[model samples]
Target: MKIQLLPSTFDENGTASRRQHLSCFVVDDRVAIDAGSLAMATTTAQKKQIRDVVLTHAHLDHIAGLPLFIDDLFAGLDAPVRVYCSAEVLETLERDIFNWEIYPRFSELKNKNGASVMQYQPFEAGREFTVKHLRIKSISVNHKVPTVGFIVSDAKTTIALTGDTAEMSDFWQTVNAETNLSALLIECAFPNELEELAENSHHLTPRNLQKELAKFNRKECAIYVVNIKPMYRDEVVKQIEELQIENLQILEVGQVYEW
Candidate 1:
């Protein structure tokens, strides 16, 4: 499996600024984790192969482009695209995002042949499930909303992605326990100067994130950081550098990573 950061704040030089958020990973080139940037970031050929989406939560920044993503590929799909998430997240999507007033409910909305474009598949919080060729588990994390971080493994390569969290222990514990973790995509959203806002919003600053990482027990694998606020990016970068974590690397969107 190959993972690529899509339209994050530090997206590489060529990607457009207006439609930036998050997305695009290749699980045999078929599964997408979050659809926020997939609509605009991917080519038509790539969209046609996206058979499943494992959403972390329903926040606009995480799931905003999902509706348009479905619409763009509705007619192009051979079968329904499976959407996996917690039961609570499904309810939030129904009530807030896909409700008729906001956008056409893709679960009920159909394509040219009257088959639905999207299908909601509820997943358990700590349970493991298979999507395509990988084994995946959701680890609950502290966020403003009901959110989950994901761990995906193809046996040899175990990768953990903390969707958005602050001072999480359980997820890091699980990561440390896993024997073959190749990479970790953790988050550092605000600079230490914005510590108050980061705390209020359930996000992490460099200092707090340092403590959170301390819980990981060991720095055995490559660590890639994501989700910095655009306005305070430089400050966050400086602070993260000051932390002096040896194996850490900041994720640049549009860069393809193989592990």
Candidate 2:
């Protein structure tokens, strides 16, 4: 499968905001893992073809552009775009986001072609299921809100995303058990200095990341780090480099990798 990181902090060429705190990855150019920063990264036509969006959680940065994305593409899509997430995350999307107060509930709105804009595909933790050509598994993680991380595979490759988690064991254990993993895209929301806030908020600092990563017996997969807060990007990079992990790379917008 081919995965490309949309315009991120280090790779934006357009007039995108530089105070970055969001990300979106194009999986084979047909599926997106999250919709945070895709508003200016992708064109309107490409956004309409999105068939599957696997949400890590319902945090604003993670789902910021969700409403606009679905609304813009509502008329062009042949079928409703599938939004896969844990039950709790789905509830946040429905109640906090799509509720008429925030935005029209596109899940209830039918397009001119009689297609709903969004489809909720609730997923239980640890269940391995197939959707279209992808094999996906959700694993619960320690977060302030009920959240889940995902292990996605397309037969030949497995990609893991640790949405936003603190020092959590279940996710590491689940990753270690995966027999075929090609890459890991995890979030690091702060630098080591903000460890207290990071821990309380269920976000990760560089130190916590090092400690948690050591728990995984990964298969030498490419570990790409995402979600470094814009203000602390330099600090996070410096601290993370000092942690001395060999295979870690900072994920930037427009960076594409085939696995």
Alpha carbon lDDT at 68, candidate 2: 75
Relative to the unseen true structure, what is the C-alpha lDDT of residue 187 in candidate 2, on a scale of 0 to 100? Answer: 81
- What local lDDT does model 2 show for residue 202? 95
Tell me the tens digit of each residue's lDDT in model 2 across 31-114.
888788655566565575677888878888878877877776777777888888888888888899899999998888788888
TM-score of each: 0.93, 0.92
lDDT for every model?
0.81, 0.81
Cα RMSDs, all models: 2.3, 2.2
Model 2: how far residue 106 lies from native, Å:
0.8
Residue-wise lDDT of candidate 1 within 169-229, one digit each (tens)? 7787788888788888888889998889999998999999888888876577888888877
